[model samples]
Target: MQIHRGLLQQASDKGLISAQQVQPLWDFLRECEREQAHERPGFRATHILYYLGGMIAIGAMSLFMNLGWERFGGWGLFAIALAYGVLGLALTEYLLSRRQLRIPAGITACLVVVLTPLLVYGLQLGLGWWADKGHLSYRDYHTRVDWRWLLMELATLASGAVLLWRYRLPFLVMPVAVTLWYMSMDLTPFVFQDQDQSWALRKLVSLWFGLLIVLLAFWVDVRSSRRDEQRDYAFWLYLFGVMAFWCGLSLQQSDSELSKFFYLCINLALIAVGAMLSRRVFAVFGGLGTAFYLGHLAHEVFRDSLLFPLVLTLIGLGLVGLGIVWQRHEARISARLRGWLPEAVRELVERRG
Candidate 1:
C-alpha cells in the first residue's frame, strides 16, 4: 500500500480533502515516508552517490581483485583489510552518532561486511589449509565454483548475520544473499563427493537453494514492521531468489511437449503467486518465462508458421482488453474472490499482510 502523488489528486477531485490542504498534506506524508525510523530511504542525490561510491569501492577491492594483491602475501593482505575494516566501522559509528546519516552509515557498515571475506581469505592463505584448488587466481573466486570457497563463504554468512542482528540494517542482506548464492555453487563438489559433477546437478542445487531463500524472504516479508511503500527487507532476497530459480528452471532440456507445457503452467502459477503476495519480482520472472516459452513454441515447434505469430498478436491485444476490464472491476472482483476463500485462509492472508 503506497500513496503516490495521484492518490492526493484523487482525494482533491473527490472533495474528500480541500484543495488548500493537499499540498501541505502531500509534503508531510512525503517527509514521513522519507524519515520513517525503520524504513529504507527513497532515491535521492545523496543516497544515489552513497550507493554508487559504495559499490565502486566494493567492486575495486573484491570483485576486481588483481594478482598484485597477492604480492602483499597473506599477512600483508590481512593487515590491509583489517585497517580498512576498522576505519569503515569507525566512520559508520561516527555517522550514526554525530551526523545521524544512517544511509551512509549503512553503506559504511556494508563495506566492512564486504571486506570480511577478503580478510578471512587472507587468514586461510596464511594457514597451510587453504585449498588453492587448481592454483586458481583470485578472479576465479567469482567465476569458478569450487569447494575451496566454503570457508570464506561460511565466514561471510556468519559475519553478515552478526552485523545484521546488531544493526538491524537491511543492506546486510546483500552480502548474506551473495554468500548464500556462492555457497550453492561452491558446495556442489562436497555434496557429490566427486569432481566429475554435471551442470544439471549444479542447476538442481541452485534451484532448491533459491527456493529456500524465497521461503526465507516470504517469512521475513510477513514479519517486517516497515511494510509501507514496499520498502521491504526481502527485496534483495526476492531478486536473487528469482534469478537462481528461473535460471535453473530454464536450463532443463525437455523433448516432450507435455513437459514443456507443464513448465509454462508452472510459470503461470508464479504469476498468480505474485499477485497473491503483491511482490512484483515474481510477476517479472513469470512473465519473462512465459514469453520465452511462447517464443520457443513459435520457433522450434511451429517454424515458418505465420499463424502462430498472428495468434500471439491477437492474444496480446486480448490481454490489453482484459487489463482494462480488470481495472474497471478490480474492487468487485477482489471482494468476490475474498468472499469465496475459507474463513481461516482469509484470516491468514489478513494477518500476513
Candidate 2:
C-alpha cells in the first residue's frame, strides 16, 4: 500500500500520470513525508539513536549521580546546571530553527528540563533554605522521598511547562511526567507531616495521583484529536500514569477473593479502555495485571486442580475465537461503538482511529 517514486514512475510509464505530473506528485509526497517526520517520531535507526543518547545523558545527571559530585558546593552545582541549560537551549534553537531537525531539538530541550531540579537544588542549598540536613546531597532527590524535594519537583514542572509551551515538542513532556510520578511519592510526607506515614497511605496517594494524571492525559488527547494534531503529547503521561496506578494497585494486599476478582475486572476494563482510545500503554499494563491475577489463581487457589487447566484452556480458546470474530467485523464493531458515544466524543474517537 506504500507509494514510492518508483511506483509513480511506473504509473508514468503506463500513461496513468503525465511525465510532468509525476515530478510534481513525487515532490508533494516527499514534502508530506517530511512534515510527518517532524510531527511524529518513528523507530528509524537515527530516531533510536537520538532517544538512546538523550536517555543516557538524562540518566547520567539524575539517576547515576553519586556523592562524589556533591563536593561541588551549592553554588558550584548551580553554575554547572545553569551552564548546561544555556548551552542546551542554544543548541535546541539551532537545530529547530536553522537546521529544521525537530527530533534533536526536542532532545536538547528535554536536557534543559532535566537540569531544572538540579538548578533548584543548588539554589535552595546556596540560599540556606535547604537547612534540613547539612549533608543532604542533590542525588537524594531521586533515591529518597522527602517533602524537602517538593521544591525541586515544582521547579522542574514549571521549567518543563515553559519549554513545552515555547517549543510545542512532545518529548519535552517526558520530564514533566516523570516529575509528576516523583511528586506522587514525595507528596506523601507533606500530606502526613507529623503523623505515622503508613505504606497504605502512600499507595492511596499514588493511586489517586495516577488517576488524576490519566484524566489529564485523556483531556489532552481529546484536545489534540479535536484539533487534528498529529503530534502525541499525552504518550508519556499515559505511560507514567499507568505505571503509578498499576504499581500502587498491585502492591495492595487483600485476603478476600472478591477483592482479587475485582482487581482482575479492573484490569479487563483497562484493556477495553485501551482499545477504545488506541493506546498501547493501557493495554500493556492491563495485560500484565491480568497475567498476575491468573498466575495467582493457578498457583494458589487452584493448585493440582485438573478442572482449572480445563477451564483456562476453554477460556483461552474462546478468546482466540473472539479475536477472529473481531478481526472479521472490526469496522462494523468500531462504528457501533462510535454510535454509542456523543457526537463530540465520536468525532474525537473517529479522528484518533
Candidate 3:
C-alpha cells in the first residue's frame, strides 16, 4: 500500500499523471502519512522510546520499589505519591494542550494512573484499615494476592477511568487493564471467604474474569472504531485479557487425552478468531498453547511411538505450507471471513486502526 516518490515518478513517466503534478502529489501524500503516523499507535523509533521511558519510570515507582521507601511511613508515602500524581497531571496537561504531544501526554497520564494504587494503599495504611496478613509493604501490592488489595484495585480502576475519560488517551487504558488483572487474583480470596485459597479457585476466577475483560475490550474496540478514533484504546485491554485467560487455561491439569485434544481444539479456535479479527495477541497466545499441547503429546502421550516424531515433523511442514498458502490469499481469505460477520461488527473490525 506504500507509494514512494519513485512510483509517482514512474506514474508521471507512464503518463498516468503529469510530471508537474508528481511532486505536489508526493508532498501531499507525505504530509498525510506523517499526520497519520502521529495520530496512530506505531512501533517507530520515537514511539518505542516514549513507551520505553514511560515503562521504566512506571516500573521504578511500582515493581522496582525497595524496602527503603517504607521508611517514609504511610502518611509520608501518601504525601509523596500525591505530589508525584499532581506533577504528572501537570506535565500531561502541558504536553497535551501547550505542546500538542499526544504520545508523551498519554504516557504521563498513564503514570498518574499507575500511582492510584499506591495512593490508596498509603491512605489505607495510614488509617490502619489494612488488615490482610503480611500485607505490610506497599510493594506487596504487585506480588501478593490478598483481599485487602481489593480497595486499592478499585481505587486504581476508578482513577484510571476518570483519567482516561478526561484525557481520552489510549495508553491510559493500560493501568485499568492491569488493575483488572490484579483484581482477578485478589477477588479469589474474597470469593472463597475463610477457606484456604486454592489454585483451582484462582484459575477459574481468572478464566471467567479474563473473559469479562476480553468482552470489555471488544466493546471498547467497537466503540472506538464507531467513533472513528485514530487511537487503539483496546490494545492493552486485549493484551492483558488474553494473558489472563490463556494463563488460566494453560494451567489446568488434565490427565485425559480427550481433554488435551479439546484444549488443542480450543487453541485452534483462538487462532481462527485471531485471523478473523486481525488481532495478533490472540494468535500469539493460541500458538503458544498449541505448542504446549504438542509438546505434551511428544513427551507423554506418544513417547513410545517412534512414528509420533515423524507425524509431528509432517504437521510442522504442513503448517508452514498452510502459512504460505494463507499469505498468498490473505486478502481474499480475510474478506471472506469478514463477510460472515454482522454488518456492524464487520464495520468495526474492518475500520480498526
Best by lDDT: 2
Candidate 1 lDDT for residue 35 = 76
The estimated TM-scores of all candidates read 0.86, 0.90, 0.90
Candidate 2 regions with alpha-carbon error over 4 angstroms? 1-31, 194-196
Residue-wise lDDT of candidate 3 within 224-321, one digit each (tens)?
87785678888999999988888888888888899989999988988877866779999999999999998898888887998998998898899999
Residue-level lDDT of model 1, residues 1-353, one tens digit each, is 78887898899999999888889999999888667743456676777788899899888878988988988877788899999999988988898889877677877888888888789878877774565445775557788888887888888888888887776677878888888899888888888875886888988887888888998887677667334333457888988997899889888888999988988998898898788777788899999989999988988999999798889889999999999999999878877887887664455355545
Deviation of model 1 at 61, angstroms = 1.7
- Least accurate 10 contiguous residues by lDDT in model 3: 128-137
lDDT of 3 at 131: 55
Against the true structure, candidate 2 reaches a TM-score of 0.90
- Name the runs in model 3 displaced over 4 angstroms: 6-16, 131-135, 316-336
How far off is residue 179 in model 1, in Å?
A: 0.4
lDDT of 3 at 328: 100
Query: After superposing candidate 1, which stretches have Cα over 4 Å from the reference?
Result: 1-27, 33-43, 131-134, 226-231, 336-353
Angstrom error at residue 139, model 1: 3.8
Q: What is the C-alpha RMSD of each candidate to the true structure, in Å?
A: 3.5, 2.9, 2.5
lDDT of 2 by residue, 1-353 (tens): 67899999999999999999989999999999878875578888878899999889888888898888778888888998999999999999999899988888999999999999999888877887877666568888888777778888999999999998899888898999999988878877777772466889888888788888999998888777666477788899998888888888988899999999999999999998898888988899999999999999999999889899899999999999999999999999889888998886687677767
Model 1 alpha-carbon miss at residue 33, Å:
4.8
* Structure candidate 3, residue pairs in collision: none
